[model samples]
Target: MYSLLGVRKKQIAKMLFYENMTMGLIALVLGIAIGSLFSTLSTELLLNLMGIPMDIHFEIPMNAVINTSIVFSVIILYTSLQGFRLIYRFKLIELFRAEKQGEKAPKNSPILAILGLSMVILGYYFAYNFIDYVEKINFLMLALLILISTVGGTYILFHFFTVFLLRHMRNNKNSFYNGMNVISTSQLLYRIKGNATSLATISTLAAVTICSIGISVSLYSNIEDMTKGVYPYSYTHTVIDANKEAQVDATLEKHKSKHQISHDYLLKTLEVKGTAHENTIKINKTELNENTTITVISQSTFKDFAKEFNYNNVKLNKEETVALTSELSIKIKKQFGDLQESNNTKVTMSDGQNLYTYKIKEEFPYPTKNLFSDTFIVSDEQYEHLKTTSKEEITRIINVENESDSKSLTADLKTIIDNKEMPLYDYYTPYQQGIEGSGMMIFVGAFLGLVFLLAMDQSFILNNYPRQTKINLITQSYIKSELQIKK
Candidate 1:
């Protein structure tokens, strides 16, 4: 269509639009049918592997289909009009001479080559070194810097350095004088100089696409493992009242007796406050907001948790305490070089009268649920003092025997909880957390990956079109001249 637009402008526009739209409609129909079929098959296969039973119903969303068709049709019409406008802008003589006049060879620069190499190395250094501090800095800005430097470096290397080296090779008498070598080298150098930016763009796109897909796949594949690290328990419930705690326990035991279920449950009583004051241990100094949560659990409870999870057990005295924080907190501490074998920090409670100093014996990955931000394990005497001084909350963490039984047990427990109106909180199971966290990440990553891959494909075709056409014309002209000489 673009090729013929110069000769029969209006006729070509009309014919091409009609033919393209017709083909597009046919493709849309077939695409929807095949896509729907495959989607249903894939869903069934996934469900079967997950041991889920469901009715298979083949359904296509009409809204999506209509929206897609409309979008494609508009794109096709706009592109066709743009092509016509481009053709009309060119004079007949210029169109004929376009193949005859090639782009001038570009000059090579050693400075640009050196600068490009330095930028690439510096970009990689920042990417590797500052990745852990992403939360502290502007992540988007850092990412853009990396991308621009790497891509600009690639272009400079291809355009200037590569040409410089190849020209030196061409200057060699023995290699240059070899049959066909001179012609091939000159042509290759010219092509590289002209198409350097396009090649660099394509290379960058391919790298980005592969990296995005690889990270997304890795996140998806390791979702269960990651979830296990963050959420060791299948269900975590907070009980405010002692009566409710006993009732919930009895209910769980009754259900366990009815069904073959293995359970390891922990009940801990602790005093929690939303804000920590100036004298707090200050475990997370990087946090901009001064508001830190204080949770004081008994030393015995801490020991029980450590024993259950196979963590190193530590004893706390009335004068000293231990702290347990989230994975992110540990990372932040490590980044600041604050993470040692042990660290002692002073903590002040909400009550001005009671000031206690504590040593952080160890840090463990804990749930980031709103209930508790940071936990301090104190001796029984300190716990009793805190309990009498401040309002104490009871928390229960339960671990199921098998991951497979978690969903069913969670459902049963939720049903039981919903029947009564009690001030209780329940944390999501690992499977649910995986779906909500990793599942959304994979979806967004895959979508962006697909868009980038498609863009790269279109760019490669568009950028190479003129060069391919020029090469074809030259080959055809050479063949025609040989035939004429023979005749």
Candidate 2:
């Protein structure tokens, strides 16, 4: 083989098997082509089958499918290359031959293994990106054929590839059998044994790569929803003080007039019924620390508040009320313990003259973000009546109607709050704070991604590399005729 190439036997074998330069170059190009095909077919096929809607002339699922495919392709390429670097420490030639061929390495299996790994990775890229379209993909049998061929191709490429390369390596010299062909055949047998680990490594890495990337993209996208749309865009400011809504509206109105920011929708709710109470200070109402309980939100105002989030718009009569979410109720129950069950130590704040109280009702899901400190919900009339009867703090919210005018309106509202002497409430500037808050989510995502990438990469290097080397050493035995048979 070397005489024809004018190269030594070892060098020719090494180049053919370890380098597999011709095959590898072709396989890489083929991988790229396959990825493109997956992308194009996934998108265009969907469009052809399901006509686009006239009113909306934008890319829908079609775009997501194609873009996701392309993205995953890039990720797969990157991860495969990384894996290759990790696997090379074992030397590619030995891995394939000792593994799959089950003989000494032709010094060829390493490159052949790389080709195999790359093809399998390409298969995965296609599979992951086209998962939704897999059902629609008519080439299921063809792809299966290709995958099987690729696996067969892996073994054949290492074992007997020299058959095709004989002319290149031997110059059509039939005179030079000299056990060289035998060596190559033996190389093939050994490679069959080691195929599992190499393919498994590639397969495992591909799966991890897909999982991590999906998690990263989905989570980051959700962070945008959480910080941007849900908070600032939906409800700019949340108030704890009930008396401040009117004052905030006045401020917003001033900002609108001054800064051309013209939209502040004001809403307010005060306590009407102090029904639910955690027994504070051993039931001593006269003592200042009588109750460190959550202030009861009135049921009447709760009626109006429910309307904001598209609640049933149900009218609250005398009997029914919103209860705490079951989860929260359980925690509250645990806190009260025996006092909660006995009912003797329990307190209901109701005076016949004004205040009318009832038994405690739980607030399910709290109707608020979990991150906040204190939370309660009730009706406007209930809140107003409570204000008249008790000395508890009120909660207010000045909703901004014009999402576009958020900044100027926030400025206007702040001015109004200052002018009216209403102390600061929880202020949420949709644009300003929303953009800045996104950093934390981004930071967390980056940190987690880095950690995962490092951990998986370490596993590849620490674990796979040695296995690769051992397999190659065994292949070396086959190639160098070091494997002695003692019958």
Candidate 3:
């Protein structure tokens, strides 16, 4: 309304208020009816196609509907009223000459462009390098640096760098003299300089929309596979004593009768006092801890497990051991050098009276989901010595015959263990964990993706609306004047 009839704030306000409110009301009614019908049809069709059971009912949430209607109505009324303030702020003379006023081209600054480029490079360096230590560093400062550099750099690129490059292009006589090239380049230079902020805003929104959607979709798609990597077992139960072990075995046997149990095994771990030293040319490191927990498995058992995963079978001498570490530890080791060259760590185990030194032969993927500590695969003799010397902990690993029975079997076994008054450390199945973790990732990713897309679309519209209107008005006025001259 203000664009059509300038210098009349009171009249514009009344007209916009009455006319916009009436139109908004009509739109609201039609929108609600059409929206509800489409929503119901889509929901019913999707649910039926997916073979999912749902109670389909035409239920209107009056509270939500009324609240939304009220909010939009208030927004329209407020916007119409607020729009009048823009007219009042403008001088009466400027309003009268608004159509005659033309936008001036902005001056380009080479120095500002250089500074912005430097800032962009510095910000990228910080983002790429310090990302690993983001937890240790001041996150807010880092974020501010990135934000400032991106916004400032984008503005400078649009305002000055673009013009500078185009001017260089214009200097080439062959390109500049081409039909419409000179005029188009000159107009683009002016447009870019004048609308630098808007261009930057649109570019940033586009980047954000792409990144958000891309990352969200990737995470949502790969959640299941990633979860499997972290948790490879169907279920694990820690048992301390023989009685509890027997109870668990009995429970497994009972389940086996119902064909719910496929296979199971026992894993033994021992806590020992040890000092480990890494002897290497790149880095010589020593770790002395009294309560280092080491997983003790026989060579035969390790070989059998290796065969299951197609890992190279490792044979450890009586005085040698192999270390199995988490994925994070493996990454750290790779950062130093080749695993074989960098993983020559000597572990000295003590039984308070005697000490045994074992050379680490190799490293392997962690046998279980215990991520907090390191695991060692030792020979049968070494395992016996460690078990007799120190306290030992045992865990029962169970696999279900059917994937669908995992949840129910885990629940039943947990109940049996609980009823026996056994001290249960933890009970989990991979199926349950995978579903929960993946479901959360999908939910969060989808929510954030939708929000970013909506925000990007809204920002694009809001930023371009006024510029488009101005351009249209200028073109219309120019055409009308040309027609009048021709007549």
Give the root-mean-square deviation of each candidate in angstroms. 6.1, 17.9, 6.1
Residue 289 alpha-carbon offset, candidate 2, angstroms? 5.9
Higher-ranked by TM-score: 2 or 3: 3
TM-score of each: 0.74, 0.36, 0.73
* Quality of model 2 by C-alpha lDDT: 0.46
Clashing pairs in 3: none
Total clashing pairs in model 3: 0
Instruction: Residues 287-324, candidate 1: write the lDDT tens digits.
Output: 31224447777877777767766767776555665567
lDDT for residue 183 in candidate 1, whole number 0-100: 60
Could you tell me how far off, in angstroms, the CA of residue 265 lies in candidate 2 after the best superposition? 5.3
lDDT (Cα, tens digit) per residue for candidate 3, span 114-206:
776777677667766765546556879878877788767777777777777777777899998785576667766666765777777777766
lDDT scores in order: 0.64, 0.46, 0.63
Order of models, best TM-score first: 1, 3, 2
lDDT of 2 by residue, 83-160 (tens): 445444455456556545424433444556556556655655565555444545656764784556445555454344
Judge candidate 3 at residue 185 and give its lDDT: 70
Worst 10 residues of 1 by lDDT: 283-292
